[model samples]
Target: MDFKYDVIVIGAGHAGCEAAVAAANLGSKTCLITMDMNKVAQMSCNPAVGGIAKGQIVREIDALGGYMGLITDKTAIQFRLLNRSKGPAMWSPRAQCDRNKFIWAWREVLENTPNLSIWQDTVKEIIVENGEIIGLTTFWDVTFYAKCVVITAGTFLNGLMHVGKTQLPGGRMAEPPSLQLTESIVKNGIRSGRMKTGTPVRIDGRSVDFELMSTQDGENDFHKFSFMNDGTQHLKQLQCWTCYTNEEVHQVLREGLAESPLFNGQIQSIGPRYCPSIETKIVTFPDKEQHQLFLEPEGETTQELYLNGFSSSLPLEIQIAALKKIPAFRNLEIYRPGYAIEYDFFDPTQLKHSLESKVIKNLFFAGQVNGTTGYEEAGGQGLIAGINAHINCHGGEPFVLARDEAYIGVLIDDLVTKGVDEPYRMFTSRAEYRILLRMDDADMRLTEKAWKLGLVKEDRYELMKSKREAIKRIIEFTKDYSIKTALINDALEFLGTTPMKYGCKLIDLINRPQITIDNIANYVPAFKQMLDEIEENRKEEIIEAAEIQIKYQGYIERERMIANKLARLETIKIRGKFDYDSIHSLSTEARQKLIKVDPETIAQASRIPGVSPSDINVLLVLSGR
Candidate 1:
């Protein structure tokens, strides 16, 4: 059998779903091929979405007209803004999703989308001709032709799961591994490496002693992921419980560490440094006598609880022994044993900013296939790759987000510039301009760009424009209106804020650390009425933007100037064939690495590990920029 499509996206996980939708929504004849249609967008590890820097990626995806935020909002059982007490830059939106519902919603959305088709089959080999990827052949001997191919085959490329000494050739639990794709890519000269990740054992919620552990609940004031569901009601949330491990738990793990796959050479791939498993953490941080274990509810209806921060690949008997030592899990019934899985991922440095392979034209990669870890990171990258693939096929300029512009920009830039050795996880610290990339204004910053490229709908663009106008009006109102001590003295004193010595604009007063726009709205009925009419997301957005403007005005402007300077460097484009070896002024290491990577921009070149400021200055002098 033979089929033709404009774009072919392999694997229907978060990355593949976003890629397919992005391409299809852009009017490409896109086909999503997955091994199991029933497991499309499956949350293989965790059932939660967004946290810290990852939340910003989700917001960026929403702004780019991707469906993740919408599906997350639709299926979320609980929502909260993490780091609420911190600055606006640190505040990130997170949600606990019903896993089954999340995947179902994804399938429903994909099925309803125009120009997108779903195929239930495993991709066996990529068909490349003259170093250009043309299509792929499935295991069943079906050949599908495409102008561009995106591989988001997350954790399924020769995937192998390990539980102590027992090993299975599966992607997750029961899913079969793709047999020949890894070999096919290697034959094409694309470099690949092994990476391992693990998930924690789940316990039946009915067997756990919730009374003995502290309950972790969502905030009283809820915040959903999508701008579309700001005011709508979602499902009622289930509570999560927290417990801690004592010395006995550590002892049990230590006694069995000799048999662990991660430590005993059964697995050689590097795992994520931030989200280490129980055995790794115990061995690495031995000074800490206890580790916290969270019992997160899998769904509102299911009695299964996800054991967060307890990921392990130790023997089953040892896992049981360790759990029995925990205060709240003395009589815990085991549901599933945690295991580690190793899979093949490409070296993302081989890809251009468009995520298209430099070695193979029209071939792209996303998700864990590119060595990224989180659902949001994969989704964000997939959306970019999908959009760019569609654009490339149309003879349009590639969509590239810069470091200072958005978190997605930072993510891609970092991946292409400085390739990660371990599973790459997003954190706010990774972005130098996190203040400018606030979650509050993701749509404001990126939607217009996406809309102009025909990725976002007209109505969504209009909504973003309207939001900008409202935010402008609110900022002007606060700037123009002054509050006299005579009017606000009592309320201010009652709230323990310093009473105004002289009259000041309400906006200026709101810049105070303790004061907020919401606090003053209650004092003025007109302010309350004005806000009540706006969309809740937009309202929060306006308030947050106002607060940031007032508080970090100088810092933001300084960063903007710095970004502007860096943008000038980005304007000077270089080819991948630039012979850095010919530049005698550069250091030997810098010259060698530059010759090997062949960075496209001076900005990217400067970010290479061994490249120095003097070398960049030499490049500027040589390029006459």
Candidate 2:
């Protein structure tokens, strides 16, 4: 077989899948190499996708023509719109997926993608000559040449799995570690560190006592992650069960502290802080009496169930003993025991905004290998890396998403600017312009740009244009249409809100927190007629988008103004190879950080942890800003 390619993506997890598809779809010949092709896009930690800020990233990925949302919508077993009680900016979509089906869907998409090939093999070392990536060598000693290489190795580099005192050399439960690649990269001047993450034990569903737990059913109203189709409508919904761990269970786990891998120093690396293990939660919050655990099904055909929020690395006997203490798990039968895995990750500060390694040209790193966690974060980086790898190979300008434009941008910026000491996960709080980057408006924010960059197809781009036009028409209709106060008094009174004193613009009424388009549509005949005139398929989204735009008009405008102000800083370019040490007026810490990160823009330099406002002023003056 021919071994030459434009891009070689190492790994087939979420990052690798997106990266391969992106490059191939952009007309570059791409090859995805993995140890096990059957496990492509494996939900290593959870059989789910999208949550909080993560949902926004997924939506953004979909908007950019990435396959994650499409595949997720097709395989999801349950769906819910989180934070519905909150404003539109806070609302996020999350899905509980059928794990096996999710992987199958990804494999099918990859196999069918044009110019993309799948190879079942482990990448042993990256081949680089001088300062640029040339290709990679597999374990079988076969060398494949490529112009660029995207490494999404995930938790396989020098991986070490821990369960109590027993240690194993594996990336996951059954997969072996990638030692040679890790060693080669380190020797190539790429700084690396260790990170720890754990997964919950799988239990047999037949042994679970559902009567003792509360049933958490899926949303009755269908909501999908992908904007391209209505695939979520046809899936069979599944229910999850919730139970609590009392002080008794905690005491049992405490007894196993002597043998626990986390406490016994068998695993010293940091795990995800937000999704801590049950043992860590118990010890960290000792005053709390109980912690909630969610039982999620792995798949429809399989009897295996995931014990969410109960991730642990204690001895198997102790885990069973603790499980027996819980009323709902008295007869629990284990499918597999939970274990913690420590893997090598490179410092993201060593990379540019395009996710390309500064140490080596045409070499990119994404996903867990960049010291970040979560499927969405990995997919976002992979998409960017894949797109940029193609761009770099074809002599095109690097494609980058600004911090104001996407959560993906915020994630990458944070990683490259501040540098992570622990495993970093995305949260809504991380993005200052989240109001402008809402999940509902991701397509409006990114589709046009992606289309210009050749990532989005013409059909999807046309759909996005039509959707935006529909939203515009709806917003204008709301502003121009006026409703009589007397006619709407009854509905307003029914809602327990103050009635309008005179004829008010429909948009003005919508600006009230208590008043919604649906509520107004019932009373205003003209508004209901206007909604009917809109295309039936486009009605729901148009109404929702119009409401958000009208209701939060002021806040959205303010955020845009702030973003515009910050845009100037980004326009002031800082040469990637500029000598920061020559700026004698800069602080010592700022000089060190600037030299280390070599930020490409003044705005990026300002975001670095050690660079102060004074340092930014110095940079601005030096750059003639």
Candidate 3:
């Protein structure tokens, strides 16, 4: 089939789906080509969307008109806000999904997308001419010509699965590897390196004894991932069972260690160190007597349950025998044995900040191909790449989010600037301005930007604007309203807070560490009445954000100041072809790395590994700043 499209996206994983949708929604005639159409948005590893810093990225994606958060909310079977005990910056919304439903929902959404067309085929080679991407060629000798091509192949490029000495050429379980595409890209001068990831086995949920495990239920009030999704339909939730690995399981793994693919040199790629396999955990922490195993339901109606923490690649019989030793898994029937997959990923240093390749213009890479892990991280990159690709196609400015603005910014900035040696995962610590990038205010921070790009719906933008106005009115009310001492004292006593000595404005009182908007409402009827006047959801969010602002006021303001100072450096642009090697004041290593990477901004150049603060100052002086 010889055809032309405005944008062609390779792979139908989280990254590809988002890329296709984003570009198509932005008015491009987009085509998504995947090896298996059935595996669109497949949760190859786990049946969960958001966790820790990853949740914030999903929320950011939603705020910027991406479909991930909406799909996650629609198909989630259970919802919980992880790290709630910590500050709002640390609180992350996570949802346990019905694996089958999630993928189906993604397909349904894509089918409904106006400008997107889905084709089932392997993209064998990306076509380039005069150093710019033209499109791709499929394995069946079909040509797809497009202005831009996004490769979100996600561990499918010459994928190899390892189980002890036994290895197979495939992506996931039954899907065949894209052998020709790997060679094609390599021959085109795009560098690739190996990385490994693993998933746990699936067991018969009915066969496991529930009495021997602890039940992990959803939170009392479910948290929705999308700002657009109300909590009306999130009523029913499934439960996850927790079991433990005793000494017996470890000993069995230890005995089989010599034959393990990871230990026996059968696999060379580095897996995610944070989400280590059971074998790695046992070997790394020998003093540990036991490890927790979460047996989560794969779907509401299905008997298959994923063994969350028992990921391994030992022989089939050894895996079964060891699994039986776990308290709740005594009668477990393995649906599949856990194994590690090693695949090719490119060094992100080769790509520009827009996720477009420096060498191959109009060509972009996202997800595992960039050496990152997690569905949320992959989706985040895909959204950016798609947005930038759309911008590039339109001859408009690229949609770039700074580190201080959104978690998506932190994710991409880290990838382009620092680059990754191991599989990169987002964390709260990685973001320098987490205070400004909280999940609650994602829409407030990004909807306007998205709206200007014609990516966000007008009605949604109007809703966001109205919410902003309502929040401002509530803040004004709190600033003007005052309460008497006796009533305030009564509320304070009830909340274990010391009574205030003088009458104060509701906002001033709210700024007190112990006096939340709810506390003020319990005391002063006026404050409560003021809240009731606004929309119910708007009321709660304003209160929450305002309270956080009051409590962390000093720290937040300080961080904002620091961000603004850093923003000044970003204004000092280093042209794409600036010769850092000839700059005398810079160190030899910094010069070498700068010549290799050719970062777009001084801020980005400062973040590169070999660059020092003094070298940045030297560059600023040399640039006549």
- Predicted structure 1: lDDT: 0.88
Give per-residue lDDT, candidate 1, residue 348: 89
lDDT on C-alpha atoms for all candidate structures: 0.88, 0.90, 0.86
What's the residue-level lDDT of 380 in candidate 3?
Answer: 89
Measured on C-alpha atoms, candidate 3 has an lDDT of 0.86
Q: What is the C-alpha lDDT profile of model 3 across 1-625, one tens digit per residue? A: 6999988899999999999999999999999999887889999988998989999999999999999999888878788898988988898998888888888999999999999999998888888889998988988899999999999999898899877678998989888898888787777888889999998888887788999889999874535788787555652589988878999988998998998898988887799989998889989999999998888878878888888888887777878888888877788787888988988998898888789998889999999999999999999899989888887888897778999999888888888887788899999999989888888889989999999989999988998898788777767887788767976677778777778799877777777666677766866777677778877654666667667766777888899999999898898888664677677778999988888778888898898899999998888887788
Q: Give per-residue lDDT, candidate 1, residue 253.
A: 95
lDDT of 2 by residue, 416-533 (tens): 9889998899999999998999988999999999999888999999989988888888788888988888788888999878987899888888888888888888888877887888
Give the range where candidate 2 is weakest over 10 consecutive residues by summed lDDT: 226-235
TM-scores for every candidate against the unseen true structure: 0.97, 0.98, 0.98
Model 3 residue pairs with clashes: none
The number of the candidate with the highest lDDT is 2
- The residue pairs that clash in candidate 2, if any, are none
